[model samples]
Target chain A: MPSRASEQVINLIEAGLRDGSLKAGSRIPGERTLCMECGVGRSSVREGLRVLEAFGIIRSSAGTGPDAGSFIASEPQEGFSRAMAMHLLVRSFNVADTIEFRELVEGWSAAQAAHCEDSAQRDAALAEAAALLDRMDDPKINQETFHDLDMQFHTLISALGGNAVVDTTLGALRSSVLGYVLAAVKQLPDWRAEVEILQKEHRLLLAAVHNRDSAEAQRIAVQHIRGFAERAKIGLQQ
Target chain B: MPSRASEQVINLIEAGLRDGSLKAGSRIPGERTLCMECGVGRSSVREGLRVLEAFGIIRSSAGTGPDAGSFIASEPQEGFSRAMAMHLLVRSFNVADTIEFRELVEGWSAAQAAHCEDSAQRDAALAEAAALLDRMDDPKINQETFHDLDMQFHTLISALGGNAVVDTTLGALRSSVLGYVLAAVKQLPDWRAEVEILQKEHRLLLAAVHNRDSAEAQRIAVQHIRGFAERAKIGLQQ
Candidate 1:
């Protein structure tokens, strides 16, 4: 918990946001104004802002003008992703448990994506995911590139599910384990060999989603995760 | 993103914990020492500690010897629960989306509980859950009592499921909506009538778990949540 003055400032700011007084993408009041309005010291206001920053609720910019201060972030997921990753690194949150939770949410996401009403826009998005999978076939690519593409593919699936909550949770969870995943990629002896097998699975999964086969979509999704997790032997090395 | 110095201090402290240098019951390095080691000001160390405090990772004591300063918390869930609740309050998190996510997690939890192998400890936990349903049948009980029992019932199911991830996530999500649920209780036109229906649902849910009926457990669990969300009309007023 923050100090009393800090808590007061946080509550006041969050309340404003909730009631539509503070719109996303708009700058929050400056430190001086907040200190005055909250009747708190500048330090207290700064502390409150720091908490928000850690939660990925707000972002600050440097160097003058209207866009230079903390703003209600229009997109806060990156903030969340970073904070959660830091926590995961600290081992305060377990990796294996997170993967298990991931299985359930992602299974649902796959099913939901399959069940999502057909629309050209959604179809285009699914095509994008499939294309990303195809792109992952390149053996010459580095682990970082492959991981980014994989992240994009998974994120797109959750987004297609049309569940904002699942998208956020899945994104956060995936981001949290990213360091381990990247490490696992390096540990993998033959990236090309494994890539072929994984691409085949991805094709099956994409086909299921495309065919609106919810059960197969979920089945393949869960199996793909469990299968890779087994082969990768994640969390085993250290 | 905490200030640079704050980040260094956070990293140093968490590294200590990861290496078994900072036990849960032990006081973390004091501000003076941390400032010296991390090359940061006292304010920076305190700021980092405050962020960790907000995350529910550590707690500080007022003035004293070994009993004082910040200690690695034995129970950090309360801190996570509050941080999440505050986030939920700000519409930075959505309730309807959260409930939808809840259905999937809790459904999986129910299925897991039903599939849990027979054991004296597990059986006793199941029995306790059943007893809770029975107690909820007490007509003289107040809304507060019923809600507490309801919370316990759900908590036990997730716990018995034996996934730390689900338990932590469920706990935080439940705590986040507590203010809404408590308020909804007051708004209900007929608490007794609704409580009766809810109790029956709980009984059926418990029986499914008791019978090791995984499919039924999952189905009933999902339905129970959907039913209550509809009745409480959560997020409806807003």
Candidate 2:
């Protein structure tokens, strides 16, 4: 549990945010103001501030001038992604649950990419994904490089889905499972057959996106993930 | 970006988790061991450990003993929820995107709850949800309490969906938007009508879940949330 002082600091900041008094790029009240309002010592205030900073809620500076103090941050993707990835790494969440989540989020992302974003942007993103599929055909490519391309291709679709939450979220889910995924691929008895099947799935998904077939895109994405999940059969003990 | 030493710490833990060398109840290497292995100072190792602890990936202690050192954590919800709620407080994501995500996850969770899980467990979970609806019908319930109950009702369904990843993910997403959701409810022009309509929707959803109608349950969940989104008209602002 968080200490009372730290919780107080968090509640105060949340209150300010709720009231629109604090916002992106706005400086947090300095230590003295926080100490008075929170009725805590300088050390407590600093400790609370450190927690926020570590969470990426605030960024601070050693230099204390008008433009050089701690400020509430707008960029949340990095922090959220890091936390999500770390939590997924703890092994409490099983392989099947991760695959289920991936199917849900990635399916939603693919469908939304075809249906939600503006046409030109959606097409451009799909085209980029298609290009990645083309690159994956290289005979000389190592498994790691191939995996990165696969991630990049799917990340493009997620981003183009036009929701930051989904993009950041699906990205984190993918990363959490990525190590095991690569290991599974490396250990496949029929590596060439695996690559062929995965690339075919990607092509079908990309083509559906290019055609602006939202339902088909979603279906393909889910089926593709299901195929991988079945083939991987990843155990808790790697 | 994570510092090199911090990244090293993350990779080491991830590798262990992947290979089954480290596990849920196991402590990571101590500070001295980490310093030597990571080739960094004591401070860097401590910083890396702090980051993991803050993310709820690990739990730590000040006391020095075999049983008192850092160990991998099972509970990721509290930390993830805190991060999500704080980020949402900053108004970084828009209302439309939030609603879209809720619809997707809630829809999938409802479908899964209806289609998967043992019949006895599913009925029991739906019964609990129905009971919450009954409690919501009381006129004495304040808007704040009603909102919390509403959240609880949805969280129960998400958990019973039998996917821990979905359960935790949707919980964080709902919590992230909860403050604004309650505020939106408080400001509704026709509060009584809103309550009646929401209860009706909840009843229909519970009925579908009870009947094991996966598609209908999913449809109702999405439509119900969409109704709330329309009523709230929640923009980027509170």
Candidate 3:
């Protein structure tokens, strides 16, 4: 067969999961059992498990009996950010494109969240944004902290939007694009001023959401992102 | 060490590529050399190579001489898509959500493409969309062909948008979401009516782009996607 034994193992396990023959969190067979069942060598079984574990598809533990075996994992989005972010960094995508991408999704998300009927969720999202803003004045605050809070702010907005796909995709993209953005921000000459403006813009975004003005919220959100992109051009030039 | 040896090897190779030590199409050292250099066994090297090969990050050909070793591959985006698509499928993301996600990005891409300064690129995009329309009526068209054309249309628009990050992110999302979308579409009644409407919408969208009407193009594109999402819902319900 053209397929490697390890790949065959991966396929069998995936098919089992899809067909409900293997349920999430259930332990898989031991190395010997898998070797016999899949008709692959022990090394192939182990390699397959290693690949699955790498993708967060399975968890492995050591001991004895059921606890010792590999189990299907429910880490749906664990490795998403790392993989995407690393790839994006290598590609060296420009700040304008990144910001534009972010704005398009964030604006849609804000529009959705603004019209969301759940007052508690809206209030919670606003509170999260407020918490991040409150940390803006920390004397020892570094670029990484700022970057993280920025992601949290965007993620909270996406979740409030109530579209799970948009929330997840935006969340992953935000995480992946953080490193490049941080690098760009740190190179800016007037970063403090820029951050202050961003903070104000964020407050405006939250206020627009509270007022249920989706248009205003969307408009401000896009502009804020565009402004960041424009500023990053200077850094790019340096 | 807490880390698996195979994963360490994967990282080592990735670092080399990112740092320019391993340029694209360069031949990687044989298994023995990697084993000695990385202080891992031959099996570990093999496992790492398997993972990379699966990723499309490298290619191996059968031979007995210097050409037998793994060589760095071009088009890393292909690997990105394969890995991402598999994961997204496993997560069972809703097709409706994926359609909505595509609408947001694709609409933006259309508008951006409308603004492309390069006449050649703009014409190429318009031509591709038109060509897909021409092929819409072939009786032998399967779901895969339909999905491929659908992706080609969106990818062309994204490329015309002139944003690598947006293009790549949208590309991955489009490919990753295709499996579920095809499954959902297969369940639809009056699939022909739906396809016809989609084709008409595609034409109108193309007209807007041809006329350089960014706003109208975006509107038509979003509506087109929303229509499919509704059809997909009906399909899922059945």
TM-score of 1: 0.88
Worst 10 residues of 2 chain A by lDDT: A229-238
Error of 1 at A88 (Å): 3.6
Which stretches of candidate 1 lie above 4 Å from their native place? A14-40, A61-71, A90-92, A235-238, B11-28, B36-38, B62-64, B71-74, B235-238
Query: Positional deviation of A106 in candidate 3, in angstroms?
Result: 2.6
In Å, residue A156's CA in model 2 sits off its true spot by 1.2
In candidate 2 the C-alpha lDDT for residue A204 amounts to: 84
Please write out the lDDT profile of model 3 over residues A79-198, one tens digit for every residue: 444445445534444445666678888888888878888677678768877887788656567778877887788677768877766786677678766655776787789877877888
Specify the highest-DockQ model's number: 2
Q: Using lDDT, give the best candidate's number.
A: 1
Q: Candidate 3, B99: how far from true, in Å?
A: 2.2
Residue pairs with backbone overlap in model 1: none
lDDT of each: 0.80, 0.80, 0.72
Native A-B interface contacts kept, per candidate:
0.39, 0.52, 0.21
Residue lDDT tens for model 2, A1-238: 3457766877888899889899988899989999999998875676566667667788776675667867898785667776777677776677788888888889988998777646687667777888898899998888899989999999987787788778877887888778878888877888778889999988888878777799999999999888877887764353
Our model 3 lands, by Cα RMSD against the true structure, at: 3.8
DockQ for every model, please.
0.43, 0.52, 0.35
